[model samples]
Target chain A: MKGKLYGIGVGPGDPGLMTIRAKELLDGAQVIAYPVKKPGEDGTALEIIKQKVDISGKEVVELLFSMNPDDEVRKRCRAENIDRICGMLDQGKDIAMITLGDVAVYSTYMYLDREVRDRGYETEVVPGIPSFCHGAAKAGLPLMIGEESLAVLSMAKHDIGKVEKAVDCIDNIVIMKAFASIREIADMMGRKGIPLSNATVMSNIGMEDEYVGPLETDRKYGYFTTVLIKKKVN
Target chain B: MKGKLYGIGVGPGDPGLMTIRAKELLDGAQVIAYPVKKPGEDGTALEIIKQKVDISGKEVVELLFSMNPDDEVRKRCRAENIDRICGMLDQGKDIAMITLGDVAVYSTYMYLDREVRDRGYETEVVPGIPSFCHGAAKAGLPLMIGEESLAVLSMAKHDIGKVEKAVDCIDNIVIMKAFASIREIADMMGRKGIPLSNATVMSNIGMEDEYVGPLETDRKYGYFTTVLIKKKVN
Candidate 1:
């Protein structure tokens, strides 16, 4: 029996937001695996998965994926993780690897996918509502329009210039994982004469404790998040 | 009594791909509205919504939105559609207006949104998976990875240089609705040596009789669609 692997995004946090396809895969999956921040902490993705269905019969695998992108450290971690996943697959085990957001958009599951494909294993991706989109939903803003394009960025400082470029080129922009870099982004948008009045920053979208408000805020949020800015006046 | 408007994306023909949030709004919405291509032709979004839920109790409003960008024509269509939607909302009606892909991503809902907002009404956007992301999922390709940016473009025929700029600036490029301009885009990517081998063209994703293959196919698909160009070899 040829084994198969699933890259399933559990969505940002709310289990209800999980795609029907993802929910089906999670409920029927024989093996469930996800990347965790450290060794002991339960993966947030697993928690999201549990909200959807019973994972009792599924074999849970913890794959360590360091957020830091140091070449040596990441390579070592990915190799070990891929080995564990590939081993399960080789045994005809159907594995569903849960991710936090959409698998194609800035997801770590891509690394595992590359490894699996390289080893001649079959792999498929189940799309999810990107947290950025969820944030836009929560914030009640349109990110793009006719002849308008949107860009999704991350927390890196270099992303600031890209945000500027997107704002200049596109109709709207969404910056993901921007909690650490919101201050700089907000400042840049302000300098660019982009009104902060309508700009929205949402953290932990779809979660019970979701925060949605004007981008310029005194309260600090540290979570998987998005900042949405629309150029057109609402 | 409060009037509410929901901008819901019905996804690309597959009812399963519709987000739970989109489904919730669709079910609870009192007024169902969508843009019609012509008087008698079936609205693409209407078909998707019909497959998922019973629209028996809801009022269906069809607004003609011809793709004429002429100033008078656009203003007149925009005004008429906006009036119809706002009229229902004014009567404390909960309205869910359907769009094909995500309402925030290259959607005509933005045009309606600006009109509604101009009429002094609050609108909430429920994000759905964009056509491009759905297309990528169907093709089993990742759009972006660590530190790499993604750009979505709808370029004019003479805008190949602009397309090149977008490709150069971003890691992964999704040229949406570029079926007419495919040869130009394909030629540009080839001239730049940007791995056309891995590029995939997906039209009508998640729909019945969808097409997913290399862009160099003899058959041509010119419709609501997207192209995924993977930036790096995995």
Candidate 2:
């Protein structure tokens, strides 16, 4: 019998935030795969679940997902990841591919899941708390209220003009990967009449060194940083 | 000693989708509160968690959240709910207020949480899977990938022109409460050159009677229905 593939979301950094279903799947998973920025380094998804689930005698695969901006390079990396995952499935080992947040939202596992299913492997995606949601909760802020809309975007890919338009049109906005563009985003929001107080920048959410407050133009941000901008309530 | 407030998200509709934190809170909760459309009706959030968490001995409070479109009426109702919740808190009873999706995203519990905190009561929010994320997973669709942006809005409150602008700018869109405006939105999408194939309407996600497919212009949808539209990859 061919082993099934489970695309599990480990949630934002907190193991306590992990869903019961994800925990149950992790407990039973024989083969676990998680994305790493580089070889020989542990990924955040794995680190979050390690304390809660025992992994003795289990096969763990480190899938390298580079931060290269080239489409060809990323495609090649995804193809190789699928091949390695399929190989484990051929050995009749059920593999649980862990992702940092929900697999459906800008997650590397989404690409892997599509390829795995296209190759005729039975794949299931288990949802987890997305990072932005956890960040909003930690900041004690609501992402969007009744009748309000929210726009979630990554500053790395979207044009500044597009981001500005989103800021004007949407009631609430969550900008991911705002490390490089925080200054620009803050400037745009200011130009759009959105006060700095309405924007909350959170990094390393649910972690010991988490920051939640107004975005500082001088502060450096890591990859896990997210900025939430809520339009002033009228 | 004053009692703390736990704003728990039951998650879409599936008990299995609930987080470990929510379940633990529910299991140990002294007072359980959930919003109902009417006094005698059981809240959807309560129904979703009832099977997994034992609530036989818990002091259950049914908070009426009317679906009135009038802003004043809704505000009055919310104020009444907060008063009642504070009453429980005054008795030194920790109250676990249950909501359908993540409390941070378009949840009534957000309002209550703000008011509870303003009243000097300690409030804690536990995250749960949002309906759009769960619906996307169930339909084997990615909410976003790479740098693609997503806009989540409710059709009921947004003007058609604003919705059109969002659909035009955002890479992916999730429209909640699309029941009444399904046909109009479909027409708008068609005019904007977004094919019906790119849009999927899912109702009652994680429930027994879930529907995931192209939006039918003729079929009537319930309040639980969510329409997900993805921009065609060029």
Backbone N/Cα/C clashes per model: 0, 0
Candidate number of the best lDDT: 2
User: Residue-wise lDDT of candidate 1 within B59-80, one digit each (tens)?
Assistant: 9988888767587987788788
Error of 1 at A42 (Å): 3.8
Chain A TM-scores, per candidate, are 0.93, 0.94
Q: What tens digits encode model 2's per-residue C-alpha lDDT throughout A1-234?
A: 889999998878788778888888888989988888788886788888887899888888888987788979988988888898898899898999899889888888887887899999999989888999889888888898877889999887646787887877788999988878888888898898888878899897766667888889888777688999888752
lDDT of 1 by residue, A1-234 (tens): 867999987776777777767878778889998888688777888888787689886899888887665889888888888888888888998999988878888788887886887899998888887777677666556666666566666665545877777666655667777878877877887888988875788887666667888775566876666777778754
Off by over 4 Å in 1: A157-159, A164-168, A190-198, A207-209, A217-219, A231-234, B90-92, B114-123, B156-158, B190-193, B207-209, B217-219
lDDT of 1: 0.77
Q: What TM-score does chain B alone reach in each candidate, compared with the true chain B? A: 0.91, 0.94
Listed in order, each prediction's TM-score against the native is 0.89, 0.96
Give stretches of model 2 more than 4 Å off: none
User: What interface RMSD, in Å and to 1 decimal, does model 1 have?
Assistant: 2.2
Chain A TM-score of model 1 comes to: 0.93
